[model samples]
Target: MQQQPGLLFTLASFVAMIAVLVVVHEGGHYLAGRLFNTRIEAFGVGFGRELFGWTDKRCVRWRVNAIPLGGYVKFVGDMNEVSQIDPAIMALPERERRGLFAFLPLWQRAIIVAAGPLINFVFAILILAGFNLALGHPSSPPVVDKVVEGSAAAAAGLQPGDRILSVNGTSIARFEDIVTEVVTGVGKPVTLDIVRAGVPREVTVVPKMVETVDRFGNVTRHPQLGIVRPAEVIEDVGVADAFRLAVVDTGSIIATIGRTLRQVILGERSLAEMGGPVKTAQIAGQQASLGLVSAIAFMAFFSINLGFINLLPIPTLDGGHLLLYGIEAVRRQPLAEKVQQWAFMSGFAALMSLMAVLTWHDFGSVGLWARLSGLLG
Candidate 1:
């Protein structure tokens, strides 16, 4: 929180990044509400005390709040940022009630609730598309272009031009997957299935842990099989191809997230591997310092994650709103107001608990606990 240059720069970059994504998210809701004829009372750029604001011609208050974390769109007859229907709104005139969010058609409400995540996905697609258009599409087949002398590849009989088929029985299609599996399974024996000279063979090897120092002198460790690609091959793609590949990239990302979550659920990953806002900010800052392209890539990944996470049918989130709509559709009636309130409360508690755990993990990652222990010792 102090004004150290590095910390300050990091906080600024994090706030700026969050502000961009949050505005995009809230703007999605606001625009959808407008399209659906729902009266949006306030469009806030941030949460917390309002620093300044202006009322638009349509009587919609646009506010910039003190907090730079995120933002929301407050619709008419809403009790809070989560868009809970105000109890008093029920007694309003029918004309007024019709304009309020509480009285909107279920279909329209669903569209408005869903628009936030929908636009996030759209943003990611467009960002990825832009990246592909500006920078050529990344294309690297699972072919070994180079083999280090006396390294794992050489020791395991991996020859140049060998096309990798799989790793430990998991088939790999992209060159990136080879690095991912090796990194994830570091210090473990792996069986690399390869096709050499049109003949299939298997090679056993253990990836060597390599220490890499970034420009900022940050040392990170990862497993390397000593096989390398001389240079990444990039192909220029047209608009249609870019868009199609963008969708494919998004799908791959979602699948990867699913696999990671499954691994965690199956106890293959430790809870300490998880992270929250602090980690996000730290990484965001680091990415920003790297370059604009790196930062944009990071934001795209985060935006997709945000969209995916919000679609889960947990209460107090956009997904939870959709869940309520689903229930109403099934029961042919709205849930009781008290029941909805309790559900929201339960959701809030769950989210806070998750945040607490993630924050604890962040502190540990930063060596806060270790530093404290040293002092107390």
Candidate 2:
């Protein structure tokens, strides 16, 4: 049995992941701003009280703060880390405003804001590409080696020696493809084209939702089809092929995320599956305990998620800024200050509420509430 990661280890892993991703994200914004000669007032890691910092030659204050949850980059003429405009900076002479972020051309500003998320995607792709180059590509044939008794696969008449050809009309190149389809189509009927004994046939299987408890007392639920695959095959690939595969993999993962979000919104998936900071830390810790390669892979996956999340068109996020810029581009004018402020406020509130709910769920998943109640009794 694998040893569970300790609390401290898990927390350290989580913090490290956040720190690296935050720097990469904010670094993208900072680099793009510099490319356009936009002045940066501060680049901070973490939030709240300052732990230590230094002023760069360009007068950018680089800071390490007390709270390690998140970080920010404050552009010139911004009132806060979220980059709200400072009216006082607007009053500065036009000459003084030349390098201010607010004064930059709309296109330049948009690029600066978008750089953060774009770089995250790039970062993930590079990581995956590197892995592929070093480890080669891994795949297993979509042949069923065994079918668990009383499982959905058994109910659907799937048997050993069956080869899956497609899932809902999507061609399955490998066993992983079948697993992905089943996982994503949890609790829904999945149509599979299969070949058995040199004969083609089809089956409809409804994956059952299953709950699991890890050694650390964390509960997780996911859908599963009780079919096992044979040994995997590893194929060597050139650098070009590796990179191409990485791009394809990254795009597929992004699309999967979009699909999952859509399912959640459409009530096809459970909100409880969504994880917050606590759950993320737990997962980070588990990955770290597995080994360096596992940890790095998790980091890459999280990087893609981070980038995708920021691109959401919620106010106060990078996507929100881009949305406003898009509107300004269409209207040839910025929205009213009041309107922008209200939107940001609403976004902030919505985010906080979501965080609260997810955190609660995370705590419950770990039996924290149960423990507390037991202690009280």
Candidate 3:
């Protein structure tokens, strides 16, 4: 079935957003290839027939296409879009195939493949750093405000207006840190160094396990001390502080995502929590509606996710290629052609299945399915 022309606006927005990230990702491969002295035949910003483009002086076809969904970099002596090796490489003269990607050493190929995801992470960090500097990253100090009556905090002799100095000797920088400390120490006693009325004292409290549901109906269990964030006061820091906080923030995000993936793998979390491209597009559209800052924040978030996803050691991804290269390095030869072929097919199928499920899930999320059912009725 043909897609309606009315969806072009949404498609255009999605394409434009994805194109920027894809450029950053594919450009990493291009630069890495150049650094490794590999010959490039074509560098496409999108797949399929060329919409319009120009060949560089080095004879590389740098082009964009009608389909702005994704991009690729084709190297000399490659059979298809990805840098998968071609059988014809064997027929080439030694010196000729030497500059080809496949003929490059295993370590070099691994670097080239891994570069794309690595650069995406760097891009995400830079974007987050920019946001921190511009928005004045709210550094809310961990000052106790409202303590739930008869709760663990109250039972521990904690009172309102007490400033939490540290948790388990890890100095508290922000109110958010308190949550981190308490949640991690769930069901276990935690020492808090508090400053109250110009006098310092130590208090020990145990966080109670509590289950909460998010907007998506996902339930998460955390240790709660029944304390709320003090108040809204944005602490402006220096350039050094901005980058330091940015790195911390980015690392925290990566850790959280890693934990979530682990939970899914362990069957502790629902698979419905995982989202695909359509889900991403829906969220992106919502964020874009808020304003440019929101959109940029969303981009930074997706950039981090994109980097992490590509770095997974599943087939057809950068990590998968790196894994193959690692095997090749150990064995001193490439895997059999049949094995590589099977792996690629499996990876492709897995990727497509994930996309299909996510797209179906997204329709329900955006109310598109309800609207369609209404029309049918």
Candidate 4:
């Protein structure tokens, strides 16, 4: 049977990506809790009412909840009133609770909270590595695939068949090297050695400084030769090269995320440029149309971003808990309950406000609200 790929496929893919990320994130908490000897009551794959659940011999209740947004693990002695604290735990002699979470050392508490983000980081690296291995190493041969008419390349007498041999008196062995020279030489006259129809020719072209936005919303200025990159044949790498490529790719993704955040902070981009869950589903549909490989790549990109965002030191997030633990470690005691309550409330309010604004922007971008307004009118 043929699989009909449509909006449904996109919706399913979006949910699946979220589910995988939730498991990895929450599994870290569950595993760390067990390692720290904390009693875990329930490990749920989603929130709200349980679709199905079962208890293990070790007394760990695992469940699939109806809501597909995220998952959680309920721990013993947690502040949540819903979790049943064993009489044994309460009676464990106040001395025992003293060193465990209700009693454990501060360092242990920090580690437990930190594990979730750490797992996410590891997941991103592994996914990138898997993709690189499967897709093959990228090649950078020096060839001009397309020359924009009236652009620098065309103005410099560059044709579609020109093979770049050197740039700005520098020898070029890789296509990437050629690109680096051209981009970095922006606003400077670059001397190019090209083999056009087997004739070695030299031309001087002043690169134009152009501003472009990366996928993560980063705006960058670079020299533009206005030539399109030709498709290079991919070659599978050895085990070592494959691993190295994965690491490099992961670093690139992290850098992109950082640049985008900086741009957002600097007001180089608007929140209207950001996408919410609705836009993400649409993107998933677009990727699915391209093929499975593209869809998987999209998932990896979003997963990396999700992991990075959750690590921000804001209240109600894992990073926020880590921040609190750090303060506790320094102060030699927990902060007042009232202070914690205030912080959490403030954080919740901020998050809700941001989400509301972003959702409106999303609806505006897709013209959903416009359609509804038209209907009313």
For all predicted structures, in order, the TM-scores are: 0.86, 0.94, 0.81, 0.75
Give the poorly placed runs of model 3, Cα more than 4 Å off: 1-10, 148-173, 177-226
Mind giving the per-residue lDDT tens digits that candidate 3 earns over 125-159?
A: 88877877777787677998889987889889899
- lDDT string for model 2 (125-189, tens) is 99998999899889899999999999999998999999999989989889988877777765778
Greater-TM-score candidate between 1 and 3: 1
> Candidate 4's error at 272, in angstroms?
1.4
Clashing pairs in 3: none
Return the candidate ranking by lDDT, descending: 2, 1, 3, 4
Q: Please list the C-alpha lDDT of all candidates, in the order they appear.
A: 0.85, 0.91, 0.80, 0.74
Lowest lDDT block of 10, candidate 1: 1-10
Q: Write the per-residue lDDT of candidate 4 for residues 108-175, one digit (tens) a residue.
A: 77777778777887777776677667888776678888899879888987888788898877777667
Off by over 4 Å in 4: 1-5, 81-92, 95-102, 139-147, 151-225
Output candidate 2 Cα RMSD: 1.9
lDDT of 1: 0.85
Who wins the TM-score comparison?
2
User: Residue 5 lDDT in model 4?
Assistant: 50
Candidate 3 local lDDT, residue 91: 82
Instruction: Report the C-alpha displacement of residue 236, candidate 3, in angstroms.
Output: 3.0
